[model samples]
Target: MADGTTDQGPVTMLATPISLDFEFTPGVAQSKFLRGLERGEFLGQRCGTCGQVYVPSRGTCPTDGVATTEDVVLGNSGTVTTYCVVNVPFAGQAIEIPYICAQILLDGANLSFMGLLQEIPTDQIRMGMRVEAVWVDEAELIPSLASVKYFRPNGEPDADYDTYKEYL
Candidate 1:
């Protein structure tokens, strides 16, 4: 009151509760890719102009902005372009502590995709390491990348950087 003003000691605010529900559908390009995963197939779409193949195709070429139409079936094997060892623990992680998360480029595809790297010691994993997909039991599979449980060492020599350097 000395400054001719009164101040409130504190203010209480109320928060409204919210409830929500959602359903989703993967569009045309991704739908086809997911369907292929259901049967352990690595399907990619090819851009007619640039001849670049894209796995989990978005139905368009990022390089040329052309519609990708040709269906290309890539092998399960690929090269690990890069990776990181995840030693930190987080809730809801299905794998054990200290696993690898990597970007793998399938043999015929131009882009790399992120996936779990398993079945080998983290110390043994490296760039250009060859790997192959390991699948879940057929009975347990759905149209998703989850069907490919993880990537494992393919017992092949590591690829030269020249083979996958562009992807890095």
Candidate 2:
């Protein structure tokens, strides 16, 4: 110990190395959804009471507050309901910042799903722009949304904002 200072050894201690390991046991609903993704399909559960559909296959419906059992496949193409330009970098994000992240309403489905936008100018990304899923190659199939790489403009005319405004 110093003359007038108390015995405060080190300012900081060394941090322990971290190792993360865990197995995910998917529930029946989640297992089915994952299997569908491996087959290049988008699966959602439908509410029998109100006919509302949820992507990622929720076991319950938010609208009617009831359990769902019906499985529906959402189409690949849809209209962009809304979006935000991500100008900040994030850990584990594949693309750089200044890219657009959008909510798309797939055809034949009543809900929207969030995805990345590409193959178009960021400035040209507007609400209601028609976009389609860009799936990863068959050899890269995985039980995750990342199986679909991203969404891209389909060269279709943009719909009016009012058309999908309520979905936002």
Candidate 3:
């Protein structure tokens, strides 16, 4: 232990840092979803059996284990199902601390997607808040979630809690 305290005797520990580089192949569902992001749009997979939609789907629905072959285009705006204010720092984190990370339930989608919420103070962020995607510049569009810079309030009325209670 770093502090050198143990019940029976002193314990020795080794610290190791290992890094590996590997290529990733996206599955059918992920390929489609990434393509939509490049076009500055949101895409989700619709499960045939459970009829639930998932963002960045795993090519199948976890609920029914059914192939989610249907592609559903989702609206950029959605309701904030829940959120947390991050105050701790970690490795490879680009955003500053004290930021809001939220689970947003996009319109027409059955699942919530995680995104960074900004343009509002942490104390002001609330559940059922209406928000919209803030995409990167057109030239920076890519096949990744990073294409959307962050989410922000859309100036609409707060959503009724009933609309997003299931997600919370």
User: Which candidate wins on lDDT?
Assistant: 3
Give candidate 2's TM-score: 0.82
How far residue 162's Cα lies from its native spot in candidate 3, in Å, is: 0.9
lDDT of 3 by residue, 36-154 (tens): 99999999989988889898787998989788888899999999999999999998789999999999999988889899999999999999999999999989999999999999999
TM-score of each: 0.86, 0.82, 0.86
Q: Where does model 1 exceed 4 Å of error?
A: 1-20
- Report the number of clashing residue pairs per model: 0, 0, 0
Candidate 2 lDDT, tens digit per residue, 17-121? 788999988787878888888999888888999987777766888878888899988788999998999888876787877899999988777778899999888
Residue-level lDDT tens digits of model 1 in 1-168: 455334654447776778688877888889999989998889999999999899989999998998898999999999999999999988668888799999999999999999899989899899999999999998877898889999999999999999999999
User: Considering TM-score, where higher is better, how would the candidates rank from best to worst?
Assistant: 3, 1, 2
lDDT of 3 at 74: 94
Q: Candidate 2 — which pairs collide? A: none
lDDT, candidate 3, residue 27? 76
